[model samples]
Target: MTETLQSLALSIIELATFIFVFIFLAAIVWLIWAYISDIRQKKQAIRRNFPVIGRFRYFFEHLGEFFRQYFFAMDREELPFNRADRSWVYRSAKNVDNTVAFGSTRNISAAGEILFLNCPFPTLEADAVPPSAITFGEGQARQPYTTSSFFNISGMSYGAISKPAVQALSQGAAKAGIWMNTGEGGLSPFHLEGGADIVFQIGTAKYGVRDDQGQLSESRLRSVAAHEAVKMFEIKLSQGAKPGKGGILPAAKVTQEIADIRGIPVGHASISPNGHPEIKSVDDLLNMVHRVREITGKPTGFKFVLGAYGFLETMLKSIHERGLEFAPDFITIDSADGGTGAAPQSLIDYVGLPIKESLPLVVDKLIEYGLRDRIKVICSGKLITPASVAWALCTGADAIVSARGFMFSLGCIQALQCNKNTCPTGITTHDPDLQNGLDPTNKAERVAQYAQKMVHEVGVIAHSCGVREPRELRRYHAHIVGDNSFSTSLELLFPTRSVKPEYDKRK
Candidate 1:
């Protein structure tokens, strides 16, 4: 009887334990289902008012937007963008206070610290230069229009940016007295709307006006140059995004209107040739530059990113041989760190030299060749901040051009969704609904305001450095940190005089 009682007690304990476990698991399952149901209900509520779907549209629309924005998104930003960046752009463009409430979302003691230089005795304000009406290469024969703005938009094709966006940029730039870069997409009617000075860029593909054999057509070139607003022309050797790679505009964005303006087919993937088909050698490039200069009667320049190749020396030699008259009017150096609408990760992260290293070498090379005075150098690629711009000015750049910063001024949220068609701020997108959100009139005014503010701040920085003009900025103004820390490159790089004129050999 004792043995039987012990067996019954063990059986009862085992059964009771099993029952308890089973009840606990069921409760957990019930909670999980309830949580999932709540999420679905919230999504349904958010998407309910979407077009073409009734109440059911709410559940599916947000679901669709989520899928499209997250999974199906072709690396673009969707609606309900990040609050921090977008808010700053909106406020800056509108000339409103960019001060945020409470403390910054940043960790002050973090590893990457941005140190601002405090002035012991800040100077009083001076009469500011108006944004509009300036000239570069004034004493030189080949001069381009220069505005006083520290920030100006970079080259982006018309098809890449919507008509309204282009119109707004043109109007804004005009009001601010800054210039607009008519990207390789070709000059369009909207580019003329605001009468902004234009920098006509000729890409490797020669899209605007190519002959039947895909050669540069003189008539098309003349037609564009004939426009009174065409202030200068830029031969795009390569961009910062993919210095050696060609341009790629997807077929979806290539609408019939775009095709008509760009003189290309509507359905095909428009890929610019990797190099200029007509330009095979350095001489060919200089000849083309002169040809454009002669045709347009304006400054002609080329944009390129340096890749430690010996060809630059050879190219400079050719320029020397060709004589000063045949040399390009200007050279725009793009750093590897430059922004792009879209690019391969490998090229962006790895290719080309950084501005810090490349700028000094190129400047030294020019100084060595005694050509520094002849050719104006415009530095691009990550020249957005005041410090960076000041560094460029001190190092040797004649002017600065900014693409991404201007986009920020135009309200780019930096969602890093540029290549996709669904940009919410209507900056990089082409969708009608998205584009409508960007009021060109208001946005244009904001562009001017932001340009003025940034320029003014830069001027303030220049004054603090004891320099009245941007050209007065010197390498002593900056400090670099890396393997070597706390020293300026001016003290390190150029121990000799400003113009070398002896190391001009081609090897």
Candidate 2:
């Protein structure tokens, strides 16, 4: 009888707890509805008179954005921007659902148009032939590097991006046959994973393998070049996102592991000098390039954001005066619109020339010097779609490098928390808790898959343009929108067929 009474008492207590929980949940739902209704009804009135609350409107508006982005929205239903593009990255990376639906969400009559390859009758399969590797320079100094499929991961430093993210990118690049660039953060073991081919970037800082005085160390550079996977070396003069201003990796994001990899003190932020102290003029830069090339015996290139008021023209003149038969193996032109890990709001919003405008200028300048064939041009900045890449190739760029698009592939929700080290998908975060969720092995395969799909799709586009390969795409292959009608972008930029530089030495 006593045992039965105790059991009864326990059941009663459990029932009361359940009732309380239900009531609490219902109250929360009602309160949320009431608040939303109240705000909607009084928003105009509050805006007119309540000065303090009006100021808070922006905060509330931004807060609503957060809720809509992470919680309230569905995977297939984000407005103005949806998850379809990112979903394609994830699907391609996993080698799943590589199919095209009947209709596009895009409006055909929109002002800004997206072009597609209308494969006349039948669709083409992925190309079987391997991309030919380009050999830069002549004789013993020559080095060969192959162009993998359409996709290649752009430079993001070990310090700027987490170790696991680096490891995953490295492993993925190896698996995909694409190359990876070591963005000015210096070399770390994470870059070695899966034995991916690497392009070691020497930035303004010259952080890794520096001399005692923190200058570019020839011996150290040679040692790095000797590594089998380090196929190329690039001199970074400036990046697209924030030209002139150097790269910065914040101290708060720098974990102990990052500190050791970059060889910096744990508490201080890693600051790159605005320009290379050793290289001041064009001649100095060329000489530095010669030394690096002579020491490494590998393909040497330079990356920059172009803003020289005839500085390129001057540089071309200097090359001729010096009797330098060859120029850089390749040149990466980053447009002003490119994304960065973090940057000043002013710089991000209003600095540098957009790629659409800058690409034609740089290409024309190089051609004017009669150096177009000798030097390859790689374009970066805002290449998000098949149409964009197609347009870039059509504009005289040898290749295109994508950054944010790949991050989307890694499932970045664009939480905009990359600088804070709180990226949701583990692509940019340093926190152990968040990173543990990103499985390198799985994510690496996804990277490979996405690369292959992008390449395949690009190949299809190439075929429709009546071109056998991507390299054949030229300015005339595409058209652009004008105020009145549609005309080729090339025609608009080059009014005449013989658009030579005003001061072409060849003339």
Candidate 3:
């Protein structure tokens, strides 16, 4: 019995030793293979120079993003949205106390930074009469949209965002009494599922309403407008992310359902024309708007990013030649610094004008032509915070919209993987496994809370400016810090009336 036990123990020891030796040999082989591969690689000089050890550079570089965001990057130091901006949105969405005890981390003297001038004797809460709701297409549409909420969701396409995200936005917007713009992707049942006010976007491709030959299909237009939820139609000429460029939906994202909604074939890269083939001249543009309105009987407007106002001046001149009644119901101006599902770096970086410059320009032009009352100016571009929204109200935006702020409310961490299919938070990805993480019912409340809080705070700013309502804010109420490191009232800088903008009163 003792001899048998000894033999068994020896066999077990030998097997363990063999396994260890094999593992060691395999590790050496992998190391040698990696070293050779790195040295042979020509794309990265560091990898070629230092072999396997240099591979650590990329690993560390990737990890550095998380490290910086969590530990090193200051509150005001990140791009697109700093930690401070994101944190505020998170807190507000969570409906937690978002007040700060310490002084602001903002660099007060940043060039062209806007500062609101508070009134000596502000309007009391008791005396404040809330701003009246602005109505669009009053005489133009069978159904006009009248909403008092100043801050609302901007255009984010159905395919660009996940099902849960749309569900949340829809329900949330409904709860907040705000509207949701259905980016050029077209209307989905989910968009109407939440029963929120819907703004159906008509892209350059004319996605939902296109015929077999890709022309405007009246039957499809009527079908979409038949829904009581769809309140308006916006003809998207260009977006801030890619002004002259078109929308690109990679082949992977065009699932059968999305293809059905967008009226495109499944599993193909859906590319919209760079410019609407039907829209060549200013007359053609208005004609398209008129056709959509006549067909859908809804407020029809066009969205675009401003480059130079030559085209705008021509359009206005044509409108005067036609009539004020011929003017489109509204104009949705997207700032150059806008968000998108996917955009070229060149266009995203340098193509369009930001809202600060473009919003005032479009508003001033409309005012110059005396069409301000006829066309509601809906401004979009990073106007997420109370101060930013208030600034737009003062500058002349009839309403403000934001995609990223609502994205944050939906628990987006700015993963920047929106174009990719692997968004960790599930807000932007179509992956079912990822979508499971977001509970639309719970997130919807957060969305509503964020919108309500934003409107309330803007009202606070209006009262501080000695105005009864947010719409009463004007250029004199806000000041911008200039290059000389001194503050100048926006009334002087982008003076609303100081410089006479050329206007051809054709009447």
Q: Considering every candidate listed, which one attains the maximal TM-score?
A: 3
Tell me how many clashing residue pairs each candidate has. 5, 1, 0
With a 3 Å backbone cut-off (N, CA, C), the pairs that clash in candidate 1 are 47-58, 48-58, 76-417, 77-417, 132-177
lDDT of all predictions: 0.72, 0.73, 0.89
Instruction: Write the number of the candidate with greater lDDT, choosing between 2 and 3.
Output: 3
The residue-by-residue lDDT of candidate 3 on 263-367, one tens digit each, is: 899999888998899998899999988888889888989999999778887898788788765679999999999975788999889988889899888888877
> Worst ten-residue run, lDDT, model 1?
73-82
Candidates 1 and 2 compared: the better one by lDDT is: 2
- Best-performing candidate as measured by lDDT: 3
lDDT-best of 1 and 3: 3
lDDT of 1 by residue, 1-507 (tens): 999999999999999999999999998897666556655564554333332233455568556744664566442133323344345556767888855677777433443222234346544456333333345434433445565554567888887777878888889999987788887888888888998888888998887866777778888888888888888889999888888888877776788888887778886767888899778888888888888777666788898898865777787778777777677778888889885576788988899987766777777777767777677787888666565676777677777787776777777755566777777888777788899988889878987877676676667776676555555566665444433334334645554245543534333
